[model samples]
Target: MFFYLITVLLGLYLGCVGMQLVYLVFIFSKTGQYHRERGSLPAGSAPAEPKPDFSAGVSVVVCARNELDNLRELIPLLLQQDYPDFEVIVVDDRSGDECYDFLLLEALRHERLRLVRVNETPQHITPKKFALTLGIKAARKAAILLTDADCRPVSNQWIREMARTMEGDKEIVLGFSPYQVKNGWLNFFIRYETFYTAVQYLS
Candidate 1:
């Protein structure tokens, strides 16, 4: 009688484990399929309708704090986006370095580049949030696209893609940024966490 009971319990545990494995596989397949559909373009296909006119305008906002190095490298890329009637706003949030002067120079150079200087953060709010608010408030365009100063767009069409996606019923578009993979456990962990966060949000 004891031997029979042990065998039945073992079988039940294996059945539960098998079901969980099946569930995980189902979720994994669904996620890959969804992203593959959303993130890729079919061969020789044109957009169904004309994309929203670039003349409608877009504001690309970036809030920086002591990121002179990143700003130097990225501002040119932002200014060079292949979209018409768009503005790039960079808010200098208490950056102790020469960021203010650098942006001031850039603004003079580019008619569409606007610079807002924040010498101090308010008593209660975080610096990043404060700077972002100021940038958005100063934006000239109704549609706003935001990105970090440390990040670069994969293509010159980044602004165009974002502006087009915002058309009709889509208020916010979520994008994925992948870090450069390196040969180290720490890098591996960071990449894992990034994908894990994306999956968590997707779920």
Candidate 2:
């Protein structure tokens, strides 16, 4: 009788764990479907129709800390954007590496690229958020586009597509960000997880 009772308890625990796993899988699948659908929007369709003679200034803010390699790749891509009246602001958050130095060199080469050095960390706890706020305040343009050190626009027309959607009195413009392909099963799983989450939140 005691043996049977022990067996039943073990079976119940395993069954509960199995159910939880199945539930998680179902949630993840649904999330992935949503993200794929949202991100699959036709190019230039995500934003609203463009207005005539509506040219607005844009400020691209990039917050960096110990991202020298990524900066080297990302900065050039940003500089190559086809936007006629846009400025790139790179905020260096007290990086211990040569990221700031590289940025300084890039700034010298590119007139549109501006560098800001944050010598002391702020008390607010979120360094990236603080850096972004500073960038926005220093921005000369009215429209602000926030991106990361590791991210880059897909093409030169990315700005035009993003800007066209900001008509009327809209203050905030949220866009989709997709992950790049990487080797290894871990990376695949991570990207899958990210896609799933984006689908759930964005869609």
Candidate 3:
């Protein structure tokens, strides 16, 4: 009789677990699904060019430490953004490499490009957080777009799209950056992990 009771309890437990899994798969859909066109206008007829939102000038902030190579490739992509009235701010956070020199040269060539060279990060604060805070504080515009030095904007309209999310009482916006896929286990695992995490969060 005890063995039969144990078997019954085991079956009940399994049923509960199965039901939870089914709920996750069918009911909860938070992070699992994403709206690709959430902030973008419908891509049909050519919409009238949006009037320059003077109140929403953007400051594009990038924090770098010893990333001269990545900066070279990505900075130009940022500087050439098709949006108007935005500035690109690159904060060189105590980099030992040629990052400062490169930024200095770039700043000279591009009027909208500015550089902030930090010689040291305070003991109480971590280096990256300090650099990011400094960049945000230094931003001239009310709107700020923060990204890493190594990141490349997928489109010239990247800032435009991100900025659009700030409309109508929205202060903070979150974005996802997918890693470049390569012919390796690491890339495959990363892709799988991303999908799994999204599913779990959405569920």
lDDT of each candidate versus the true structure:
0.85, 0.83, 0.85
Kindly report which residue stretches of model 3 are placed more than 4 angstroms away from their true locations once superposed: 1-28, 32-54, 194-203
Off by over 4 Å in 2: 1-54
Top candidate (TM-score): 1
Per-residue lDDT tens digits of candidate 2, residues 86-169?
A: 999999988999998899998999999999988886786688788877888889987988999988889988777788768778
At residue 16, give the lDDT of candidate 3: 100
Worst 10 residues of 1 by lDDT: 29-38
Give the C-alpha miss distance for residue 28 in model 2, angstroms: 11
Off by over 4 Å in 1: 1-52
Per model, how many backbone clashes are there? Answer: 0, 1, 2
Count backbone clashes in candidate 1. 0
**Cand. 1 Cα-lDDT:** 0.85
Q: Could you give the C-alpha RMSD of every candidate to the true structure, in order shown?
A: 5.6, 5.7, 5.2
Tens digits of per-residue lDDT, candidate 3, 1-203, equal: 99999999999999999998887767656455655443655668555555534568999999999999999999889988888779999999999999999999999999999999899889999999999999998999889999997678998988888886677677877776767778999899998887666556545
